[model samples]
Target: MDNQKDKILVVDDETSIRRILETRLSMIGYEVVSASDGEEALNIFRKEYPSLIILDIMMPKLDGYGVCQELRKESDVPIIMLTALGDVSDRITGLELGADDYIIKPFSPKELEARIRSVLRRVDKISINSSIPSSGIINIGFLKVDTNKKQVYKNNERVRLTGMEFSLLELLVSKAGEAFSRASILQEVWGYTPERHVDTRVVDVHISRLRAKLEEDPGNPDLILTARGIGYLFQKIMTSN
Candidate 1:
């Protein structure tokens, strides 16, 4: 028996939902562990070290936002927020807290499963590709992006970035000065086509997060620039005498 099955931590306050997910995900070959509330979720996470987390937003003793924030402090594990709140602001809040993605309540099981697979695939791809040799380092201003190590540094000090964040940066940096539209970025980075009515503000949220970490003045970013009417682009590094 292979012990390498991807472990998933399902955190929801609803017992039925937990049972359903456990059964469904287990049938699909994942090892599913669950917690009924936010605090227990954290405890289980520490012990299980799951490959992914499907976290519900509303719960007692803490909340999904708290869990996501705590996890981001140490782990870059993929998080997909499940929530009853359908407001765009609520979704943005989850994304801002480092959640990799989100799904609203009454979601189709198939859609949720697909999302799970997509997030996991991204994680696997990043892990495998980071081990391969590539362009060593890209210097942009005071920042150093080490492609080989999948790490970044600012003024020789290490900068913490989630795997997804690094992937986004790599995409833009790979084609510096090339403007990538939000739709293209979604296709290239998230491996999905945006639905006509689906809010693609996720891309903007992530870009903001990246700028907060990478730019000296996030309000007026110098490295990652907005390509007015398009989307965004990485500014070519400028050399000063």
Candidate 2:
């Protein structure tokens, strides 16, 4: 029960919703912190340095988007904006503003829990990758992986990635054309043991994120390929396209 592992922040104007989220998240061993509006959220965010944020797009002051923008200026903490089911614009705005993910309103608590667990797992994987030893850059086609610096580049342009995202990319690129199973990815990327019931759908979410960051076209991905219900493959980008 590491205290640092449990840190989270919840921002929503609805008192009942906030209270419910606080209670539910706390019951699952998270250090829950809540704020009613964006202004207070910014203050608490700076003071606490939370690991993840559950933000509401609509608020009285500052709003979730503003809060997300302010936080993005300081850190790469994961954010999940809560938006209405039909509010398509806010979802785009949230992602464009550097939010990590988003959730529509009336979401099931279980889904939220799954997302939290996924984020925590991904963050943990990133921490481990940073400490591993890498002698030099590993390149496949136009993709360049620098283990020593823990950096990546495509055709000379630097590509930004979170810790887990980088590890996942490196693994696939390191073994280009070989498709891996969901469980195989969990064991290799996350270091999760066999007994753990870790949901492998997390792998899907991460691949999506990686595509958004690395692909010229996320819809028809050329780098990260999905094998229906199987897993993913990393295609070498031989000469820019």
TM-scores of the candidates are 0.90, 0.66
Give the per-residue lDDT digits (tens) of candidate 2, residues 1-241: 5533678899999999899999988987899999999999999988998888999998988988898888867777878788884745546677666665566788888878776777666655432333233454666565677755658788889887765667677678666778888788866765553333334545667787788877778999877999767788877543221
- Candidate 2 residue spans exceeding 4 A from truth: 2-4, 126-137, 140-150, 153-159, 163-168, 171-175, 178-233, 237-241
Candidate 1 C-alpha lDDT tens digits along 1-241: 2323799999999999999999999988899999999999999999999999999999999999999999999899989999999678988899999998888898888889888887777655543344223555767789888776789899899998876788888888877888999989877777777885454777898899999998999999999999999999999773322
- Least accurate 10 contiguous residues by lDDT in model 1: 126-135
Error of 1 at 59 (Å): 0.7
Q: Quantify all predictions' global Cα lDDT against the true fold.
A: 0.85, 0.74
Q: List the residue pairs that clash in candidate 1.
A: none
After superposition, candidate 1 runs with Cα above 4 Å error: 1-4, 126-135, 196-198, 238-241
